[model samples]
Target: MKARDRDDEGRARSARPRDGLGRPLPYGAPGVGRQPEGVVRRPAETVAEAQRLLDDGMPFHAHEVFEDAWKSGPAVEAPLWRGLAQLAVGLTHAARGNTVGGARLLRRGAVGLAGVDPAHGIDVAALVRWARELADRVEAGAVVDAAREAPVLGGGGRGRRLE
Candidate 1:
């Protein structure tokens, strides 16, 4: 096997190109640009950026944004961000046609989100419900459309209103 790439700190990293869904492509294949990890953002910024990516049907990129929030935000908010990240990944998997994997992650994310307080401006209840329902649909052989069903992540539950 070829040697895996490593970062400056010797942590495993890939400089590989990735499709919109974050799937690795051949070395020279064109792919989406990735957001740099560890850039801290305020809660609103994180939500807004993630919402935009989801609207663009780029759940994997949105997942990375939430991941940054989970890692760089306060410990208390880690679960919330992490749950959101997982939710995005679930969407990514579903869109890519990984039914079982998608449903599993969606359920996991919903479980994590269920325990969080809703004072963070995210409609946690709606998200949990959406995740559960989507998981069910996905399991029943529904085709996932990430953009068309992207959840409204902000606006006091009014933002990113789904059409």
Candidate 2:
């Protein structure tokens, strides 16, 4: 095995460490690296799958799902998915106590989602509203409970398809 590769314990010596929010830290830093495989772009066929991940307190994982869609879905829908991913990452940051970063990402995500069509299986207006509100709160230094404030994809009722 190479020096930077995983050892018998399955730990990669050269893996970039990450903080609780799943953001990569400096190499050789004192923190655990998130499992790399979970970020693979599978491109969820339905928004419900991503919603479930968010509801389950795994926004970072949900971000990966949205990211997959952004990377592989229809070209026109990339912005929507990218926005969702940013929203998820913002929530992740909030949960990890990075209020400033959380607010910034939430605002950016809201901006990205602002112009998405509502008929595209997501309530774009509602999402943008929620994101903006969350961003404001985070910016005001509010301690957000991620689980309680987790955004639901495709709205609350009637599941929506991504394709």
Candidate 3:
């Protein structure tokens, strides 16, 4: 194909998928890197994907994906995804210097996650701690730090890094 065929109004057609990440998926592959059909997508998978997006600095996308899963998954697992998604969104906002939004979202996420069991992949205590810290900082009018505190896996705060 000629260069002109790849261009629309002088802008070259992107060879990559719309995600900032490079590469176009092959035929039948999902657009966002994960296929949505027939696969058993647990809340853990949704949270993990959300974490990846957050790490890539795409908080909004992360929140959206988790929200989708939270709405459709089992009730026992929905809060986990919802809470985590909000947490990521809050962090994104904080990174962007929006302390108020960050605090609000974080606290809301924590509230949404309260009383949920960790076995369901929801770390309620850690989330509550994170929310409290953020809320305190926001209340004191402290600057939002771009660095995110990592989530711990297991009761002893060991085993694996959640983010």
Candidate 4:
């Protein structure tokens, strides 16, 4: 079969590219574009915004916010933001029913948070613990309610209105 053709099982081939985690890229989607590492049009200036996105059940958007911080913030703080972004993406995967991917990203995010200080406006330790627990549950085939389980950004503070 041709690369663009269906497989032997007759499954249609995907035309979109995939990210590192195998999530299909929504090319041509509104507000979507190819960004280089450390580049974003508007980075989240505070964890509160990221939290609001998560509480609103937009983990994918939350990931972008975190990614912007990771890429554009101080070098010393990159890992923490990157880890948070990964966790958000993991939640997004879980919400979409990709358990394995969710678990993997959760674990990775948890590990990335190791040795980070919590003074960066977020509770790093608590977030890591939550990520690990979520990862375990996902690995065991639990269905995650992303909104109900969304992480409280900025030291467990209240997030903005939910979606």
Candidate 5:
């Protein structure tokens, strides 16, 4: 078997490049740059960066941002971060045509975020609503345009919404 690529810490990791939707591509093929993992950032920074990634139609990358928060941020906030990560992955799946996976992840994410107090302008209620609605629509045979329909994460006076 071919040896797996190892990260600097020597853990095996995929060296394959990935597409915009985070699909693995052939080695040596040009692909989208990946979001660095395990970055420790302030809550506001996390939300800002995540919003930019989502606006850029890179939900998979956004998920990485949320994952970092979930892993490194305050324990009390883990669920919100984790839910956001799942929601991003759901969008990724939907964009990639995995309806079942998309719907499942989306619902799971919404459940994770349900009733969480809004923190750092995350607009938890709006996000949960968007995730649930999108999942329902996608399951009912609606096509997903992840980028165009990406939710505007609250911050900078931008209201929470999906358009």
Candidate 6:
């Protein structure tokens, strides 16, 4: 049939159960073929999207993206992304006088970002150093000096351009 029809049929079939080899997963199956080990597959993507939203001053939307990714389970960077998402929401909260929530999320995000190196993606030591330093500053509770901090955080502000 048509592509849309096929997709619809697939979704419908996926709702039912069958034999193991080629069976459709029951609702909420932990890992369909491409799903992550314990988490759903989109944490990384979700994080990127959330970052985009956050840059656009859409903290609420970013929070939802991170929340959905966080629920996916055991993503390699889910903790980091979720923590960052929480941080964004916390910033929003703090702006609205929710210091408790903002501090909590920022603390969590810093912890989550520990030991991660953006240079791993491109093998650039400078980038890694920058990322590590940014994470360190965040954890140390210093006001993030974005201007001086940009190069150290890799790509001279690549994160901002992503959105």
Clashes of each: 0, 0, 0, 0, 0, 1
Determine which window of 10 residues in candidate 3 has minimal summed lDDT: 152-161
Alpha-carbon RMSD, candidate 4:
7.8
Q: Taking the tens digit of each residue's C-alpha lDDT, what string does model 3 give over 1-163?
A: 7343264456565443433222255545555543232234575666566555555555556667767877777777777777877876776666566778878888888887788777545467776776667667776776654334434323323222443
Residue pair clashes in candidate 6: 130-152
Residue 140 lDDT in candidate 1: 100
Model 4: ten consecutive residues of lowest lDDT: 29-38
What TM-score would you give candidate 3 relative to the actual structure? 0.60
Give lDDT per model, in order. 0.89, 0.74, 0.60, 0.73, 0.89, 0.44
Tell me the TM-score of each prediction against the true structure: 0.91, 0.72, 0.60, 0.70, 0.93, 0.43
What ranges in model 2 sit over 4 Å off? 5-44, 155-163
lDDT of 5 by residue, 14-96 (tens): 98999878999999999999998889999999999988888888889999999999999999999999999999999999989
- Summed over model 1, clashes come to 0
A best-first ranking of the candidates according to their TM-score comes to: 5, 1, 2, 4, 3, 6
Best by TM-score: 5
TM-score of 1: 0.91
How many residue-pair clashes does candidate 3 contain? 0
Tell me which of candidates 3 and 5 scores higher on TM-score: 5
Clashing pairs in 2: none
Query: Root-mean-square deviation of each candidate, in angstroms?
Result: 2.4, 6.4, 8.4, 7.8, 2.0, 13.9
lDDT for model 4: 0.73
Model 6 TM-score, all chains together: 0.43
